[model samples]
Target: MRLSLNPLAFGTAFALALCTSAALIGSGPAAACEGRTTLAQSYVGANKDVKAEYVYCANDLRSDVSTSTGAGSDIFARQNDVCGAACTTYCWTPSGGGPDPNDCTVIQDALLYDSENTGPLFSLDPATNTSMIVMTYNTCQTYILDQTNSSLTYCRSDWATLVNYIAFNCQATQNAHGGVCVADDQRWYIQVQHS
Candidate 1:
């Protein structure tokens, strides 16, 4: 009897081994977004065109404000106080400026927190997956919040720098794991993942 090895099976196994090794090494790109630290670091490291400060903004502060209890208005108003004159209540209005729901308050609060902190703010959420990162560049800032169990990545601004930063970081991280990143409707999707 003769023994033969299947090329396809062998190749798949080899790729899996490589991925497992890469993850274990811990020196290469992360296997997934994981948390705010990984996301913030990757974004800042991969993007150099924008001179910005990136930091993690845990959802604790936002969590206390209940959108269902009609506290959203109070919360937004407080955020507006933080943002001062730059904040606008009609961020989603067509006549205001496009359809981005993230207003100046969101960006300003993130930037303000970044300026006051030395490092990323750790999340208290049990999942530890729902987190955000604030990137402040020039006069404007934006938020990149990761959705739980969703491939749809959201960014606050339409600025080219902000958009490119997210796309570049997502693609780079996914590529390291043998995946492809695609951007559509301001959301990034990873089409493939290493088996």
Candidate 2:
């Protein structure tokens, strides 16, 4: 007597095996969500030592977001929009512009906190002439108040990071201008009238 295996059964088993292998090998869709848009802008005050760079991620479905400056040996401060979630922001300014003596790297990490509303995270108060960099992970959009121009500037991320981390830098500067200057990662600069 001769026995033959059912074609349907063999096909189903083969498909299941292939899917299991793909998942185990990490070839499946990503578990974390990615940002729909990213934005990075650098602002320098015309008068007084007020310089800052704002980076933002909007509609980010990822778990968290973080970032840092690229160059320069100056003190840096950062804030994010992870309102209720576990978030951490830190900066290590080497005594000068070079690698750390101890071979250490600056780190900004934002972990799982609340997944709902990310943030208006930072604030811009024209009355006080103060501005803050803000970021939001879950929300579809983010904004920063252009106090000098008396207008609202939108911010978002263009790509995604491991933890949905997005960041930029802000340094104080002294110049002279009546309007607001905006700079982005693409190196585009524009002046807005302070209305």
Candidate 3:
């Protein structure tokens, strides 16, 4: 006769499987907003002229205070008591769908205008199931004090550059990937299927 297996083993195995699945699913876009095309509503303005990620302030510094959690004040206090009168807050807000019919050519034209100074436009066919991701490097620093040593050190601001990089490439890549559509790093992809 076969020995009865322990119930605890089965429960543990099942829990492990569930956790693994959840981790994988969570890694991608959130379900609430997944598959819903999102447009870049930047502080600068929406790029309705071109089918591109809207330029939000374009590296401009913030004119007023942002967070009140004292993060800004703390950062300012440590930095030689100088947060400066004009500090920048680089960010994007979710708007609506990707580019419309006229967006494709418009964006291309805009890129052409800046072609002299920008990188080559990366494109891929939607049928290929690949995306062109843009990337860049930036550095910003705010001093912080250590509780144990009571010394200050520079914190990283690399994320600012990464945000800009995503905004730069996401639209073009999505346009190419979505059968000539628009998309962003937030995975807001909208496909305008060809007739």
Candidate 4:
């Protein structure tokens, strides 16, 4: 089951998930957007503790939000993609299609960019069953709270550097997993930036 998400849902659900129980934890990107072709780079050893799971705002194909209420399943929030000033996370797969509409456990912030203006930074090749996912961490917080988060700052202001950082970490992760992370019939490739 896949789900598209938004920050508003996470912000609103934060209290609910917290008050619910401790069992809520653990969960689980890519494709569509053909402006760039980025493959997984070598992962960094010093940054192994780094998390490479939040990559929203990269749009090639678009979808609405769904709920996947699971333990620790929020994809985290950020804004930059479709929600405009609002926030949303989009979880979609070419095969299974869009996510279940009621799932809110997975969170990824939406963005507001004219598909006509921005070209594409990533793309999904269904033939190879591969997708290059570009991620921005803490992006929504930076947008909403104006907090000092390095990842968000880097992503909002300087994207090239952020993309480089993401590529390096992605390589490192792929190295650990034999140069690939596979699920279903797809092989996932990633690029990301964070604090």
Best by lDDT: 1
> Candidate 1 on 1-195: residue-level lDDT in tens?
999998534533442332222221112211234334533343232223223323333433232232435434544323221100111010111121221223223333343343335232322122444344444444333444332222222212222222222222223333232222222111222111111
- lDDT comparison, 2 vs 3, better candidate: 3
So what's the TM-score on candidate 1?
A: 0.23
lDDT rank order? 1, 3, 4, 2
- Full-model lDDT, candidate 1: 0.28
lDDT of each: 0.28, 0.22, 0.24, 0.23
Ranked by TM-score from best down, the candidates are 1, 4, 2, 3
- Indicate the residue-level lDDT of 21 in model 1: 20
In Å, residue 63's CA in model 3 sits off its true spot by 42
- Quality of model 4 by C-alpha lDDT: 0.23
After TM-score superposition, the amount by which residue 103's alpha carbon in candidate 3 deviates from its true location, in angstroms, is 4.2
Q: Write the per-residue lDDT of candidate 2 for residues 125-194, one digit (tens) a residue.
A: 3233333343232211112333221222322211111112212210111111111122222111121111
The predicted structure with the larger lDDT, 1 or 2, is 1
Assess every candidate by TM-score: 0.23, 0.19, 0.19, 0.20
**Could you tell which candidate, 3 or 4, scores higher by TM-score?**
4
Cα lDDT of model 3 by residue, 27-48, tens digit:
1221121132222321111233
Best of the candidates, TM-score: 1
